[model samples]
Target: MHVPEQIPDHLDFVGRGWHPLLTRLHEQLVAVSPSYSVQQVKEKYGTLRIHLYTGMLRHLNLGNTDWPDPDQAARYKDEDDAARALVHAAEQESARTCEACGNPGVPRDRAWIKTLCDDCAGHR
Candidate 1:
């Protein structure tokens, strides 16, 4: 499938319309933690799906037996929560945005599910 050049290679599977949203999400994620990296980005059931590489959580020994200080774990948990919230927000937005033209739209189901504005949907 066609992919946008502006987006990072990891997000090439996503549509151009979601590029801005994903970019903003990335910026917000980086602000949360430089260690965070995108694992995968794709469209699933007409909505955006973003998976992040949470190496920090592992490095911090979140769920391991060699758990470190409790305070450190708490801080990492907060950061992880914030990151998850951002991803959830972006996914919710993608549901209403036209995947083809970036216009406000609703999900349509035909051969496959996709979010498209009235104009784009009509053309389809």
Candidate 2:
């Protein structure tokens, strides 16, 4: 594990084997690109939501449009709901099976906490 004293300005070890610095360089390149930062995205388009990015990429053919159409908005909402549901299901499943005690964990709050399943939650 050898870390360079200072990263070079334009270091290119293309043909050399695996380098950990490559990951950092890639991240820096993405950060500097117009397609990366939310601030840059907001400046170009008012909002910084993922759906907005999707709309910009998919619907308007990546044109210089800001607002999403009603159809796109609806689709985005549907996708959001589906994602939330998947997260909830995953959290609930995790709590339902306790690796430590093999007892069922209880859901703290139905609104916020994921509901545990019967086996691990201790409660029937």
Candidate 3:
């Protein structure tokens, strides 16, 4: 029998969860030009330029609101609105069902309706 490897308890910036993709992204960001700091990067390029970069990054990772530029903020808002529309469309198209049990009812937690039953969601 093989034992599974354990993940560490605290992952701070990546947020708390078993997200390997986030972990991998964190590693890649650290690996590429590791010496530069966020402030340094921002200062090197003007604030607006940095904000543009931040907006691009925000699509990949949600919790990256360092110093958003006006254009970037607008772009992020648009993307968020589009995502909401897509989810609304999905709900309208699909039968009203509990994602886990497939029971026809309003989901207990709509945010996590994708990967969890009520019982499993609590435990996880």
Best by lDDT: 1
RMSD of each: 5.7, 16.3, 15.2
Q: Alpha-carbon error at 14 in model 2, in Å? A: 34
Q: Give the per-residue lDDT of model 2 (tens digit) for 55-90.
A: 233334445467767887776555445433433443
Candidate 1 clashes between residue pairs 3 or more apart in a chain or in different chains: none
User: What is candidate 3's CA lDDT for residue 85?
Assistant: 46
Q: Answer with 1 or 3, whichever has the higher lDDT.
A: 1
Q: What is the lDDT of residue 3 in candidate 1?
A: 24
lDDT of each: 0.76, 0.32, 0.33
Candidate 3's C-alpha runs over 4 A off are: 1-65, 96-124
What are the per-residue Cα lDDT tens digits for candidate 3 across 22-105? 234334433432221221111111001111112244334444547678897786566545433433343332223333333333
Q: What is the alpha-carbon lDDT for the whole of candidate 1?
A: 0.76
| lDDT measured at residue 74 in model 1 versus the true structure, 0 to 100 | 80
Find the candidate with the highest TM-score and give its number: 1
Question: Candidate 2: what lDDT?
Answer: 0.32
Clash statistics: count for each candidate: 0, 6, 0
